[model samples]
Target: MANTSFLQLSPRAQRLLKTTQDFVEQECIPAEAIYFAQMAPIGSTDRWLVVPPIIEQLKAKAKELGLWNLFLPKIYPEGPGLTNLEYALLCEVLGRSFIAPEATNTAAPDTGNMEVLAKYGNQKQKDKWLKPLMEGKIRSAFCMTEPAVASSDATNIRTAISREGDSYVITGRKWWISGAGDPRCKIYLVMGKHHGSKEEPHRQQSVVLVPADTPGITVVRPLPVFGYDDAPHGHCEILFENVRVPAENMILGEGRGFEIIQGRLGPGRIHHCMRAIGMASRALDYHLNRATDPARKTFGKLLHQHGSAAHELALSRIELEQARLMVLKAADTIDLHGPKKAMVEIAMAKVVVPTMALKVMDRAIQAHGAAGVSNDIPLAYMYASMRTLRIADGPDEVHIRQIAQTELKRAAQVKDQLKHKEERERSLRSRL
Candidate 1:
């Protein structure tokens, strides 16, 4: 049972939590090996086509059980009609099993991409793209990062979308375009500069919808993480050579890409942190069980009783729970005050959660002895993964800068208030 000493879910969320937890324990857990095994054939390729039949069966089962589209709000037609907080409980359960997310149509890149389209897309854009995405009939990729620039500084993005009569010519080389290699990935939402803008640095960029089959589009290769191909799904490097699309394909008008990213990323960022909390929790449990078990130890004493080992495990547990609370508090803030008011909390959680996950994973790995480095457990993968997250959605340095700036601003305000109070007190004394 979870330590409910800190926070409690509403009745609806409680029900959602139970349903998803049961689904993971029953369906997803049993099918993990099958899903991974199916991935073996496509190990060399990056297309996510191998599991459609299996996923269709799983999706059918999930939808029939009223478990479909648990990732979205009520505004989306297919969702279970839950708030971010409610959906977050379901997400945590799904996070426990990797297959559970896709099984319920809540997988990443797609989920984040769908969210952007849902908010900023015009009717034609929505009808053609958003509808298929929501239905899970097709997948999408978000093309923002590039190999040629410091992508962390989004304003440095050099991808060019130039106007040419009634069409736009897009030319750029993009890397880390996740889900681009999927056979079913029929669309890309590309972020690039709209060449006519002499606008604000943040406002010169625009998001355009590009069909996968568009002319002059080329997929160079897929990138691997820790030598794992991540096949059936991949992060691809692609070249857009004067790729032409109708000007109407632009989303939310020109210069609004940053705005869309701001809105889209708040939920996406928090969700990633939440899922990471689950991953760390799972790794800690696996490590603790392995180290403490009689068969895994020498000299007849449980490893949990070992001096430094026990302390590290205790620390990992505390860190994991602390990070989880931060994530939940961020979620609650977003739910209650909206993303605008919750920006500080969101940024802070992003910075804290992944770093905490990395620390917990490192301790878990050390406790595993040599087997930690091997694939025997998910610890090694989790560690590598958590480390990557420190850079994935903007590196830790950038986030720290934001956090510091926020703290300094608050401190300055406090200083000003104190000075004003002293002036008021002195004036009152003189009058008396």
Candidate 2:
């Protein structure tokens, strides 16, 4: 779907991709304006309490159209059986419209949480949490990041999870907890350090399923990204004041937190990158539309007719195509090999895709002049969302470091080649 041959996709996935593209263009994009209008104004108490009715209407439509939970990979029996690469093709279409992701129930935190439960959760856990999640009956949050530490290295989280009798008590403060502010967000997949474990730092951590209604849990406020609240599914700052859950909620037993998260984040990161490509494509659309408008002229020439504007727009297109190839390669690699083996590709996509999207959106914004930065067009909001991807999951520096380390593995071999070159040069110099 990333401009690849149709032969690369199964017939079924191809059909789904076509269906999803049409659905987004016809239904999802049209409904976005209404969805925004239906929302309770920002800063209103009802912003969190009341969801847009249009979203439910769209969700019902999406379900009827067979577009629901398409994020679930083929490995899960409960899913429509799309592979990661296949879902990625469709995901870009969904990313074009903000409402599309939620309408189809493929939004973040939930997607990652559902993957975790499906892969690691016990029968009881699956039935209780994963079922409702899969059915779109509830939303969820992943509470791993902490305000007190550099959460990029997940092992640094200071949240305390201690076993006490029949339950485990969790105590810590977490920020940027996406989806925490949603009223429908009923469960939390919380990651914390197990108390008094002498195990290695990575092993001492674990994730537990916490019900949102559990005692001592407080949602302080939603944090904004570049001043956008992203209400209803806000990234929130929450305080867990001795919140407790059953010991049964511990996912895949103790000391396996890193393992579980590593699995969850790899695919999730790819999903985000794919969505970013979609956003970048949409921004380019806005850019072209504004630039080619005959009424909008600079020095008696249309904006696109100007060499500078044409060059910038052309460069944006080239950048998008180049970056998309990398992301598609990463997705295909994930399909062929597991995410663990595709870490280099995934890291490369994670680093490059967001950066690409930002540049593309900036060009689109410049084309629109002042209107682009305002809420007048979606470009500003789109820019903010893409910008966050640089830091979320893993920051650009972290992924760059991973890529560099992989390259550095060849340093010794390069050193030997350098020695050979030196000897060859000496012999040539002596002959001369």
Candidate 3:
């Protein structure tokens, strides 16, 4: 339930939510094993080249069911006109299964890239890339994280977008670029230093829309999380050596990359949290199912009958509900106020939800004993992804620092107010 009983969802969003729930549970979850089974073997050249057949089948079904691209919030005319709050509900359902996100064309890197194009790209850029992306005919990657510097502080990025006459020559190294390994990935929304910019340090960077097929682009290797390769769609290390595009490809003019990312990441952080809650919910279901399995009794009683396991289940349930409420609140704030206003809430959710998911899933794995760590169940893989969430988008430490800075914004006023209150209390005591 995610404790979201009070959301006043629009009729269309409500309908989509139900449909998404059914699709993820009945189709995506069940088809997961078949989807994996159909993949090219790990060491094969086709491993990254061939997507499993089951995924396309699911996509076809999802499109028929009117469940595609639900992540785009209603503000963008390019989107399906659902609010951020509405999509949060549907996104949780998608989180229950690994294949559900892409099946519905609501996966990350793409969703975020779509938003970037819709928000910042020109008409030419939109027609060539956004149209194909929104239609799911092509995929894209966001190249921002670099290996040489601390990328968390985005100003430290050294990738160069050098202008040569009427074209921009881009040269850089980026790693952990999601979706870069996909055959359908045809564009890259790259962020790099706008060469020779005299603006402030924060404004020295810019984003550009580079066609993926352009010369001098090389995918060096795929990066794995824990042990999972996530092939077909991978996180990759790529080199851009003098990749050239028309200067018009620069997004929203130079010196605006920081502003663009802030706009992109706010909603994205919430989406990640929503999906994590869904994963935690599925893990809790595993906990309950395994805890009550009659054939798997422990010490002559069902596992849940044991005091320790019972407590763990209760704790997980509480944490799940709390995590859900926090995420939904952040979503509603974004819908009501906009992403900039919801920064504090988004930061809190980003910091909390992924960690909460790991805790809940870890407990579920423990309940399953040896089967949890093995390939017999999905918990281990799910945990690996959930663990990575803590560092993705923006890591917990980054968000935690943000939360603290935001909280302290009112510290001076609060200190004065508390001092006044103390003085009044003393005055009242003296009069008595």
Candidate 4:
């Protein structure tokens, strides 16, 4: 049985969380302007995929302070070995800033990829790609989502990976593959169908590690989210036209892609939910700051004094607190039990957090009126990113379906157990 009690962080986790909070507030948040300045000319040749100098400086500082690689639980010797719950708290703090995750080497795609490599990659694969990824020397992308199918259903993916003599030839077109547009992104964990119609649908897919520089691989374009390209870490459309990698590069061999995805996405979903909470909290902060401004008045009173505005703030607080608890509970479930056992909790959080975050950001944007949507504040971008979460990883409908089915099955089991208990009681009473 899962432990469904209050979770207490270890002394080490508490210290690390405190340290991370301090680092984000003091250093990461302050560096946003410089980061934006570097990313201002999104179409420029040099700036498009360039990591800002301030970010590197902040990364060096984060490394010096031992705040790097706090995401991986037990994979790397250099990692701090924090559990999912512990890392969720720190991830919330990092979510306040767009660049904070990469600064501390705890970013997504990389985090998921690192975990996959640590758990499944052979030593040679680890030495070639995972080592640099863990060290933050290079970035990586997960090529799973495709443009030709409804990717929410993994079985619908059409990318094909066929075995050749001493190598595997991968042929497909994938889009929304985050991090593929970056110059530093040197590797890709590509997911494709490995078996033909004869095989089981789930088992037919496989994941292979394709070097970004492999022949016939093309980065078609960087897809933008609500006009924001998220430069240096873009979601790209890529074409793998007969791209070939050594047969040894297949992760965990063929027919294990779905298994790897199950392991990878459980944590990834929780991490996204944790960060969404942080983003919503930051949006609330922005909203409160704007509303409480003494000079800003609406209907002959300060915005905060207005009844509707006040209610919005109150509602935001309540919703954010509830969403945070759900994320924490999901993280705890993943920590205590395996992902499979915690699937229901993860699905619940995955569905709730993003929706809640979008609501909070919408209110924040409304509160600020013009400045909210403008680049003057981060709310617009935050909203766009949060909006994407509703569809990314798995869509809301998919998670909702999963959670509902689990609940229905649980209800049926409860009914059966109650009936059995009643039967036993009746038999005992009759004997008495």
Write down the worst ten-residue block by lDDT for model 1.
40-49
Q: Write the per-residue lDDT of candidate 4 for residues 105-135, one digit (tens) a residue.
A: 8888899999889888899999998889988
lDDT of model 1, residue 319: 86
TM-score of each: 0.93, 0.96, 0.98, 0.94
Q: Which stretches of candidate 4 lie over 4 Å from their true place?
A: 1-7, 75-78, 195-197, 417-432
Candidate 1 lDDT tens digits, 180-261: 8788889999999976688989999988999999999999988888776566668899999999999999989889989988
Q: How well is each residue in 213-232 modelled by candidate 2, as lDDT tens digits?
A: 99999999899999999988
Each candidate's number of clashing pairs is: 0, 0, 0, 0
In model 2, which range of ten residues has the least summed lDDT? 1-10
Q: Pick the candidate with the highest TM-score.
A: 3
Which residue pairs of candidate 1 clash?
none
Question: Which lDDT value does model 3 have at 243?
Answer: 93
Q: Could you tell which candidate, 3 or 4, scores higher by lDDT?
A: 3
Which should have the higher TM-score, number 2 or number 3? Answer: 3
